[model samples]
Target: MTSIISAVPACPQAPQAPQAPEVPQALLAVEGAGLTVPVVGGGVVEYANLDYAASAPCLSDVAEHVARVLPYSASVHRGAGFASQVCTSLYEGARRDVARFVGARDGDLVVFTRNTTDAVNLLARALPATAGGVVLVDLEHHANLLPWRGGGRRGTGDVRCVATQPTLEATLDALAAELRAAPVALLAVTGASNVTGETPPLARLARMAHDAGARFFVDAAQLAPHRPVDMAALGIDYLAFSGHKLYAPFGAGVLVGPADWLDSAAPYLAGGGAVREVSTTGVDWATGPARHEAGTPNLAGATAIAAACRVLTALPPGAWERHETVLRDRLLRGLGALDDVVIHRIWPDGGEPVGVVTFSLRRHDPALVSAFLSAEHGIGVRAGRFCAHPLLARLGAPGGALRASVGVGTTVAHIDRLLDALATYLRVGPGWGYAHRDGQWQPTPDDRRPPAWVEQYA
Candidate 1:
């Protein structure tokens, strides 16, 4: 692969360069599965695709799994064809796999939706009418918060929004106070901060929620890929996550929890699969997953997600943890040395965090930073509110900050590219300040074209 460098001004290097394991070429292989992004050139398009918090790349195993089943696609359950039987078996098998993936209890229902947002919306709509006074963290993603807020607008109850504080203890204190003051139905919190990558105290929060007689729904979108999750051990009542974030890249998600709420409530989307029977006067809703999966489900997508779970299970947890920690620390150290960069968080006391790091460039819009990284340096990252508008608004970061999220396939070279870009951009000072008429950022001529390697996959 070629190392592509843009025309940004240069800065002095630090005294030392950290020594880490060489990034494996096999892991960087995104070939053979269709995409032709090249890996060579002086301006080697070094893809530091650090946006795993939003979506991770599909694993080779997942792609193969989908391919193996694609030829057998047919309508499941209703048709008696051989292909249909295979499809039905694979789809249901995927459900069982998901159940095991989350450590679901016997008879726990796994309802597949398009994504975490859809799963959360399903839960929100299904909660009993008496589910008043839901508790939410100020740091929650829009998908987790919006459903409840929208429902509250219909007069469910006083939906309490817990304010942020200096520490987790303080935040928990405020949450406890809110739960005590009202009849709370549920407490929704993230397993990790998408912005900070700091995982919340799930066990402690779970115990607290149960003690307060409220169900706990954890948004594990970020944590599932980095670590193992045992919902039963965590004592969470409900759990939601997406396949795309788990290296599956499929339009499938899971909402697993206690069956009472889901069973009694109406289907989220009124359609064929959800109804057991229909008459002129009324309709009977099926129980468990069928009730919520109203339309034709994405059987292949579900299989891919299940395949991702199996692939992740084969990985050595200790190695995965060690590698990610080293990568994160290396990147943090490099970014920390930059005078203009302000990182969101670093575990000074040596606490564990996921492979996500967020920051802001001084006196610059985050979107510009992201654009320069991509257009000039061949590094892809996400910027802006990241769909957590409330959290961004609370932090007063209206345009949001540049967020570089890593994953299992990421490497040290990728991190180096990001640091080098930042150092270069710092010397240039908000490179090319003219705003486009369409409200988009237009980088200089040097940044207009993508790196040469990108054409390999184009």
Candidate 2:
């Protein structure tokens, strides 16, 4: 743990910031690996969770880390006793571990927040006034898009969004055109797409942004879990990500970037830890991460995030890519062979993306498909626009899509299970009928009962 704190790389200078799948006994084990859930026909099936893009199950290692540290948890930065001191040490150390995980520059600031939304909003508030504006793309999540959309509390005239093109090269050209048209403060992009699982060339984007006199930022919520991020290597100026997406449960996130603008900006919150002096007449605010994080922090969340970073970083080189590739390929092939299935993609001339695939069955509503899968087959997948309304509009899927993402634990058997379920559903349809209620689809006259623990608790 101490070693992780010291492993973050220091860069000369610069800025910027910031998937799915299934099956089998996963190549990698996660929490709830052997858990069973009640399904249709009064029987149980191992939950076929194919929704890593939304929120992943806790990693077994991360759970163990959480349990190990809970006893030492206490008031952070305020306590003087051994537990408090230890807590404080761990709390502060998380920033370093996270920084190391993302290969953040030496002098970069890692500000902890509730999640990616909070992280993005923090950067939105801290951007230097002199900096022109932020350039966004069509394929951004709401967490990235809404923060800078401008108007009301969000402010306006500081954002410009580009439309994606047919190919990645064309998309880059489109992005470049947008940057050239104006001297923007930053070129913001997602490191890996959540909807289509596309990974734009970060190095090229960084070069494009710098050439246009704009700093580059990446929302790595999707990319970080599948690939490594080196701000220096990628020429990124800022980054943001969520621990929930990284398989840590207590809801932690990070915004890593330069100190210049953040120091110049006002504190994100007005509270105890964010000040050096507080008199009635005037108050001197604190700087660094404390400037933005101004209250009792989530010690467990931060620690869990740090522990997850350690676990991911320790995996053998290319381990994640190898695991997800096999499962993703099997899924893509199976889905492709299915009739009347439209696989949505932003870039036609593409690359091997992260393990996420979104598609729509020709005559099936995505909600019904998801509900049917869950109720009848014990499979879990995301069914929605995925919060990138613009991108969904571009793809002509305003209604929504069904996304299946994989993790290291996902296996060939799991992929086959989902494929088989989808095939069976498309061919024969559900034997039982479903109804829409509470804004979702579910089996009518459902008889499945909750587990004993849930029933007792409820």
Candidate 3:
């Protein structure tokens, strides 16, 4: 019995697992978190999206809200089904939400359009026939300038372009003088410069416009996302903004103002929803938002935008301002450290700017730098006139410049990565050859594959 017995070998104990590195909270969580991009050197890295000025990444909350509502989505206004009723309620509710967010007055009307450009163009069409002149500055975006210049068949009065002064106060004074000299019906200005991120004194400008018997209109596309806009409190007669620029990249925009001009003018579009009755001989138009929101509306877009406004408004006061200020200061300090980097700014006294910084390298092409950032590092940025050609010409960079804009989802680490990449590019030029074509820089003999999602969609 002793000979038959055998002892079994003892099994080794399992090794304890190593600790995982702590994951830091984002400066602001947004959709596309931890997205990876393929670099030109055959490796994938986390994508750093810094092009918020052009189009901000959708907020996570907004995306979730849309997803939740998609199941119950239906045509808004004219349906008798339960889904239709829900959709109608949601659409109307969205209008109310946006109005509350901007502090719209009692008689103000909110009309949703495709984008800021479309919203401004709609307003242009609605300009009063009695308006003798339309005054604007050279620093305005094409959306703000071109609409007044060509206001469809209504003709947007005599267009007057005012020159921007070195100081904000001087610019306001010049604008006031022009307003006083001419019978200007409207004084259109950007709440914040899309090119320089410099915010003009809105209250002062509003007063000047009113004093000269002109209605003050603000293109708040750049200002609304960074700062809260109170249309009633600020004495703004009309305001326009795009949802794409406000962390809701749905194709929708808002033009909120008094209803008199909009209602008096012809419907912006001749279609089903715009018309209350249409016969072979003549047509009677529907009133309120339906007059301009022709055909079936983008219910999802409006809802998503409303969700974004709600999320932003719910945040603790000054939370976003504090976060962006810190990031802006860090970005400016980093850029200032680089000797060859020249930042384009409007104010010489270093006035407070939003989270947008435009700059140009001493010896490098802006397009090439932007391309190199994407190819070498996974950083995304915008490099061009930024839709402000006149402003760029005045700033002495007609060729163009690089813009690294920040918003929700942008982090200090992203800014550091961009600055470090710029420094590296300055120290040692790009490893790959690039050629300028069609006003853009592209890598020669490009061999990088598209991301998996793009490939699947394609």
Give the better candidate number (1 or 3) by lDDT: 3
* Model 3 spans > 4 angstroms off: 1-27, 151-156, 349-351
| TM-score (all chains, Cα) for each model | 0.89, 0.93, 0.93
Return the TM-score for candidate 2, rounded to 2 decimals.
0.93
* Reference-based TM-score, model 1: 0.89
C-alpha lDDT score of every prediction, in listed order: 0.76, 0.83, 0.83
lDDT for model 1, on a 0 to 1 scale?
0.76
| Residue 3 of model 2, lDDT score | 12
Total backbone collisions for each predicted model: 10, 24, 0
How does residue 181 of candidate 1 score in lDDT? 86
Model 2 accuracy (lDDT, Cα): 0.83
Q: What value does the lDDT take at residue 364 in candidate 2?
A: 69
Tell me how far the alpha carbon of residue 337 in candidate 3 is from the true structure, in angstroms, after superposition: 0.4
